[model samples]
Target: MSFQKLILRLAWSVLIGGSLLAGSTQAQQLPAARDTSFTVRSAYLKEKKNRPSISIAQPALPPTVQASYNLTYCTLGARNLQLDIFYPKAKRKKGYPAVLFIHGGGWRSGDRSNHLPMAQQLAAKGYVTVTAEYRLSTEALYPAAVYDLKAAIRWLRANAKHYPIDTTKIAVWGFSAGGHLAALVGTTNGDKQLEGSDCNTSHSSSLQAIVDVDGTLAFLHPESSDYQVSERPTASKYWFGASQTEKPELWQQAAGLNHVTSQTPPIVFINSSIDRMHAGREDMIQKLDAYHIYHETHTFPDTPHTFPLFNPWFEPTLNYTADFLDKVFKAKRWAAKLGLSLLGDSEDYTCKS
Candidate 1:
């Protein structure tokens, strides 16, 4: 066996051996412990130190946007999955488009609160925005997070009447690990296998668009950082419950790139200079092109992986995200009115450092 495969084999053996000794029943009784090491403040501090002038964006509810926090969207046994919604207090005749923001923490850490500023800002722009919390790798495994995110989408649709949301115009935007989930949720719309059995099954979980902020599209792709096997167990390993070698199929199933089809919605990629953060993006874009799907890519040079949480890059990220959503949703509204099938234009732009 190859060195990488050997290491993965050993890692799996150690993980399984430890779990067995701990007792399966004992493990199931309690929710897995969350990795709380990663947070917006920690990320901001790290990035701020790297660049002295950079500032962390504070979360604030603008006067025009009203927010409802800790609203339960789903309940798994004893665990209550919650989300925060920020929407314009002013009503609109046709209803406002919606965007669900997912925060990234390698699937093991980070909270929905990380994206509060983004959600608040987007709500001020006349879109109903949500920041949702999901089961992390510590609490659940691979498909659990996916299932929870889909439920959040369905929850939004189910409560559209209450929130004045234009159910037809909804998008998912996520950062890092959350970005991976967002893309997976966007591509796997209507996919029965990934769609969990519970939580507002009557309402569709389909998304009109996806914004993946530096999230990898494919976990198993050659260009992916996830493919690089290590002696120590990685975050993906924890989430998958095994090494890539032990569960290649699970890794591939979780990859958004594997699920892309003609019916997949338009996607915009906002990436930092880190190439590893966007592994499998180019290949996914190729698939998007084959299907004539609309997509855009914006790369910010010399920025941290968590650039969206800080200033300098933060405003640009917000603008790009809002502009892209408006373009896609507006085109959809026009198409619906005119009865014309239209796909928005695609572009690739790089922000100079």
Candidate 2:
């Protein structure tokens, strides 16, 4: 093994005992260079020991949904980031609301394809759904992924006419690390510093709603598990390129909880039983409550961290997400028609549940 692989193996050993290598033979088969690339298959293998009968969700599109693959949204230096868009074939008179899905891999590993199944399901439910690729920690650290996601949002808006999307009703949905980015994007609308200087600058990167799946809102919160294994390099450390103590400002800047304001959009959080996975959630919700911003929280008891990719929790996950998006986006549409703002004490125009 390479020195890097050896170190990673040692870190895994320290984190989960020697069982890390013994748990899944498939994990050992992956290329050492790409071992950190988290995928649905790898997640299944990791969770199988806990839920022996757990099944993986397969990618299948409904007949009503048409998908376009590998559409390049932005080109950074020599790298071209691409996205997959799924939309209903039957066009809506007012255009469909758009949702951009970001996959979780602890900021280093997940791919856009991780959420393709969810994208197709939501597309079938009358929304333009997109799965986007962003810079991983291995490629670029910290705000690069954030910048790429915001750029993707801008691309969706710039191309709204072609895809039957309502430019005014775009939301971001993310899993784990991606969920962190999604929530951050929702809270930091019009943030010049987080917004990159490439691709679709003419369009705004603001989001109407946010769906965070098992993502932490604050990295330094007491409830966070980020630095629990002090000896090993945590994913946040890798992505931030520094320890929390070494660079507290960067950590706070990336935290969704630190950015929440009254202008922040409606948000829904779907969580697993793991408390550390959704750390800083309750505190952020407290802020939302103080502002009276619409938000919902749902927890799946006794489920694996990656519950949305598995069978039993997959359908419910989809239901909660779709229901939340429908309520929030529909309310926005209603408010637009009545020329009333949904922000502030407009509780009557805001969505519940």
Candidate 3:
């Protein structure tokens, strides 16, 4: 292994004076954990790949980074839930702030690999980025994808040490269908109904921040924009398994806007100016303002639905996202959770009073 890969390996090893192996990394979040403990899943680290040098801010460095692909984060009913992880070799003992990238396909068809270019670009900029695959509506339904991503979050935290990651600074970025999932994961932080079974339950699925690009926020609309939703079964039927009238509760529950609270993480909405995708956005922004949580929005006038994920618009999308995340990662709430690098040796120092 190269030095970068070696540093990553050292980072993953059991931290000295910490808990034993095999336990979940829940202790990273909970204070007085009677059962929760730091953990290490060696299986996830067994495979790693080094890619060619990719230039970003400056000229190319010889050894750039490595990507660990198809690493199992969870397994449910004959399918293995996996994710591709990319981390730069720019050694940071404090690890890198991670963003779990979810793809978009109306909650039915989309592969995690679609975000590979985005992940590589983001990773080159100094953040650990993960592109994850979740159980779709076909394989599951309603909150199964939610639970899958949540489980992925827990699994990521569980294996934080193995990769250069800051457990507290985790964020989520999604486009379209993935955007809804991202919003769901970000807002439904503590709700147990959406949280699924047996995937690293110890750690939090809640995000420190989110980037929702043209996702469906509120299904309930009052004809404010060009888009329209039918009262009968429609696009959402694939995921919800019923029409809005048949399962009003499920529709309401699945709307990311309904779950937003004062505690919802800072978010940026990169939307197409003509799109009505953010149906309940104004109301949710009011809730966000009521709580004084940081938020912003950037709309591309006359752009298509996938503008944020494509060229031209994608440039601004990347800038806005990176900037927002850079700021969010440094916020007091997230910074306070920094283990060592962000805090430095001073965290180990105490006054000799």
Give each model's clash number. Answer: 0, 0, 1
> Could you give candidate 2's per-residue lDDT for residues 174-203 as a string of tens digits?
999989899998899999999988999999
Per-model TM-score, in order, reads: 0.88, 0.86, 0.74
lDDT of 3 by residue, 230-346 (tens): 433334665666556657788788878888775677788888765567667787788877766667788887665656544555567778888878766755444444321222321
Per-model C-alpha lDDT, please?
Answer: 0.84, 0.83, 0.68
What lDDT does candidate 1 reach at residue 295?
82
What lDDT, from 0 to 1, does candidate 1 have? Answer: 0.84
- By TM-score rank, best first, the candidates go 1, 2, 3
How much RMSD separates candidate 2 from the native structure? Answer: 7.2
- Stretches off by above 4 angstroms in model 1 are 1-32, 332-353
> Which candidate model has the greater TM-score, 1 or 2?
1
Task: Write model 1 residue lDDT over 1-353, tens digit each, in one string.
Answer: 88988987787677655544323434433546667899988887777777998888885679999989999998766567899999999999778999999999998899999989999999999899999988776666778788889999999999998998998888999999988998999999899999987789999999999999999998887888877776567778777877788889999999999998888888999999999898999999899878777788999989889999988888899999998887777774544443335643421111112
Candidate 3 positional error at 269, Å: 0.7
